[model samples]
Target: MNMNEKRFEEAKSKIVGIQRNREGIGTLQEKTVHAVLKNYYAPDVATHEVSLHNYVADIYTGNEIIEIQNGNFYKIRTKLEVFLEEHPVTVVYPIPHTKWLIWIDETTGELSKKRKSPVTGSAYLAFKELYRIKPYLKNTNLKFCFPLMDVEEYRLLNGWSRDKKKGSCRYDRIPVALFDEVVIERREDYLQFLPYELPEEFTSADLAKSAKIPSQTANLVLNILHFMEVVERIGKSSRSYLYRIAKDLG
Candidate 1:
């Protein structure tokens, strides 16, 4: 690893170690966001790294950005509302009521527990907030997506050692697979070895630095990728998810 990467990982390990679950939510969210972008982004647009204080964003190519808020849905919406009004951009929010279920390998097919879905409450809020944005989306052309996950397929491939709380496997086998299956079109920027997009074993902090995306977004993107079949979470004493390209892509 490079000097900056090593330093960041060392520091982040201490932080993740200290707080574990409480602090992990942000990382999880960020990972998921990145995964989605990797799956959907187009190649022609030039991408760059973005970072703020303790947070990093995935590779961003365009001048305008649309941030999807799941954490503090209302608060994030409010912030985006103001920003979208001031800038020439489109901000999209996933509906909270859109339900997702987990699929387990066992015959019973147990689903992962969901906290709060955004499909219902957030849509109204997003609409109201969009009005505050000076009707930007009305006249502008942009890309916005809120795709659904086949939660059943992901829930079944659960590699218990993935994370402390057992999230989807974006870290190891899932993200890699998703890259080809879902995000293959946008893999140009992150493809280190042609097919691979992200680092194989990176700390939350390391990812935060490299992607220039927030830690929370990174975590979210990773989990979503896990659900998509590109990575796997390793269950262990110091639970950490491993990012990987699925060997089965053959």
Candidate 2:
């Protein structure tokens, strides 16, 4: 092999070794679920692709498998379908917060900021696919790990882009499942950071317009923000009152 290829292999090996040593720190997809449980659930569990079986999932919460889906959802659907046929586990795969199909203005093969999600129509088919493997899933002591999950935590956590003025993701929650109560505890920060991508404050009107949601929904969001003192009515307009997110961190 050429010197460059050899060097590349050596680097890759080092990264793998590091991953093996620090199993808690997983990939970007796994990190998404880690963030989820860290935020909502108190007790959580996650695992990186530490070993090779059918394949290593990003995060496996004890209740189910939480995978941060980043690429072709169908390919993951296929792999997890096979794995579920063998192992006893509930699967949760999170779709990233990519643009909705309505926003896509580009050609099918072309990539864009407005890429559409492929899994929207057939989420239930994923469950039906499990039945096709029911024979395998029926094995009790056999550790039936059939069935996979398609979690959308990555989509939820997409607000952490460095370009944004705020809302950076914290890596505090990993390797665990968080109950819903945790979300209640941090609701304010949740909205402030909006761990997942949503309409940025700047685009509330445009997004509301595009989604075909009534301006009332936008007003509702603004009201919720106002209740939290995150925003307030600056004035009345043609439809709704103006508001802004609160600035106090405490």
Candidate 3:
């Protein structure tokens, strides 16, 4: 097997062993995705869930801290502020590159057929969460790790909509395999997100087309990139704003 595949399998094995021996203690009680990622990033049991300052780190490698956050960035703002003061921190966020949806009937305990989601995932989705913590992006010690994976999402048929899909609660996301990883540690690392076909000055719609992401996501991506000085607001193109890569970045 390839190195990444081998690493993923090893991580899964580690989590299984922990649950079997520890009786699902502490972070082991977390969902499969979080547990697997914690082990995948740092397999050493010694480094898993180390206490630093007043917060518990998901993984501390002595030199750096790795936090696996599967939810909103707002929750980790305080923890990050304290950690960033003394050590470099890399926040690992998982995105389902490919997702299959399975819905369970809460009353009958019956599961519906698994269906693939129409929307594909991308690293650009991170901008939504990153925007919440824009103030911290400038810190040299702050880094981001986005792991793209194939997943099976289990949800309950407990939504407000007619089909019961809207506003549904996700029961769990089981990671099937690791596809790839995107690590952003420096200002220059943001360059990979911009498409080569983009013009010197482009609108969010233009970026949306090039990046193949929704216009809303493109706007959020620009918001973060603009704050980082990776892109500058050059001018206005009608109702839309025109943006160009910062000359320094170019």
Q: Which ten residues in a row have the lowest lDDT in candidate 3?
A: 19-28
Error of 2 at 61 (Å): 17
| Most accurate candidate by lDDT | 3
Candidate 1, 38-154: lDDT as tens digits: 324422224423442233323333455445443344454444444444333333333323334333344443445633323322122232333333223333332233322222113
Write model 3 residue lDDT over 12-50, tens digit each, in one string: 676645453223322335888898988887778899899
Model 1, clash count? 68
Ordered list by lDDT, greatest first = 3, 1, 2
Cα error, residue 228 of model 2, in Å, equals: 1.4
lDDT of 1: 0.36
Q: Which of 1 and 3 is ahead in lDDT?
A: 3
Q: How accurate is candidate 3 locally (lDDT)?
A: 0.86
Candidate 2 vs candidate 3: the lDDT winner is 3
